[model samples]
Target: MKNLNEPTQENVEFMIEEIKVKLRMATAAAMQASSFTVERYEDIKDLYEVVASKEKFSISEVEALVSELGQLRK
Candidate 1:
C-alpha cells in the first residue's frame, strides 16, 4: 500500500479535482431536491438557515455535510 500521508503532486491534483466534482454534484443535487422535492425540505431549510443566517457558518458541520451531501447525490 502507498503512504497515505505522503501524496504525490498527481495524487493531490486528482484529489482536488475529485473533491471539486463531488462538491459541484452535491450542490446541484441539493438545489434540485430542495427546490423541487419535499421529503427533507424542512430539515434542509432549517440547516440552510442556520448556515446562511447572520451568524457565521459552522466549518466542521459544513465539512461533515459535504460528505453527507456527496452520498445524497448518489
Candidate 2:
C-alpha cells in the first residue's frame, strides 16, 4: 500500500476496515475450501502484515480471522 509506517489515525482506521472487507471477500470466494491454497494464504498473510504494521495491538483481531479462515478451508 502507501508505506503505512506511522500513518495518520484516519488512514490507519480506513486501512483496517478496508483489510477486513478484503478478507471477507476472499473468504466468501474460498468458502468451498478449494481456494485455500498458496495464493489465498499469501493474501491473508499480507492482510495481517498490513494491519499489524500500523497497530500492533490489533494483530490479534486479524489473527482470529486468519485462523477462522484456515479452519473454514479445511
Candidate 3:
C-alpha cells in the first residue's frame, strides 16, 4: 500500500480515487484527481480521512463534503 501520509501527487490521486469510491459519487467523472494539486494535500487528506472513517453518509453530508472539495480544487 502507498504511504498516504506523504503529500505527493501519487498519494493525492490515490486519496481522491478512494474518496470517490467511498462516497459512491454519481458525478465522479467530473472530480478528477488531476483537478487537484499538492498545495491542497492537507485539506484533501483531511477529507479523505473523514470519508474513510465513515461507512455511510447522509445526503446532506455528502453534499457538504463535495462542496468543500469543490472549494479546494484548482
Best candidate, TM-score-wise?
A: 3
Tens digit of per-residue lDDT, candidate 2, span 1-74: 65445434444444444555555544543344333443344454455465555543344665676675555243
Q: What tens digits encode model 3's per-residue C-alpha lDDT throughout 5-72?
A: 88999998999999999989999999998999999999999999999999999999999999998998
1-74 in candidate 1: lDDT tens per residue? 22324334443333333333434434543433322233333443434334334343355655765655444331
CA lDDT of each prediction against the hidden true structure: 0.40, 0.49, 0.93
What is the alpha-carbon RMSD of candidate 2 to the true structure?
12.5
Winner of 2 and 3 under lDDT: 3
After aligning candidate 2 to the native by TM-score, how far in Å is the CA of 19 from where it should be?
1.9
lDDT score of residue 68 within candidate 3: 90
Q: Give me the runs in candidate 3 sitting further than 4 Å from their true place.
A: none
* Cα-based lDDT at residue 40, candidate 2: 42
Clashes of each: 0, 0, 0
Assess the local accuracy of residue 20 in candidate 3 as a C-alpha lDDT between 0 and 100: 93
* TM-score between candidate 2 and the true structure: 0.31
Clashing pairs in 2: none
The residue ranges of model 2 lying beyond 4 angstroms of the native Cα positions read 25-47, 50-63, 66-74
TM-score for predicted model 3 compared with the true structure: 0.95
Better of 1 and 3 by TM-score: 3
Cα lDDT of model 3 overall?
0.93
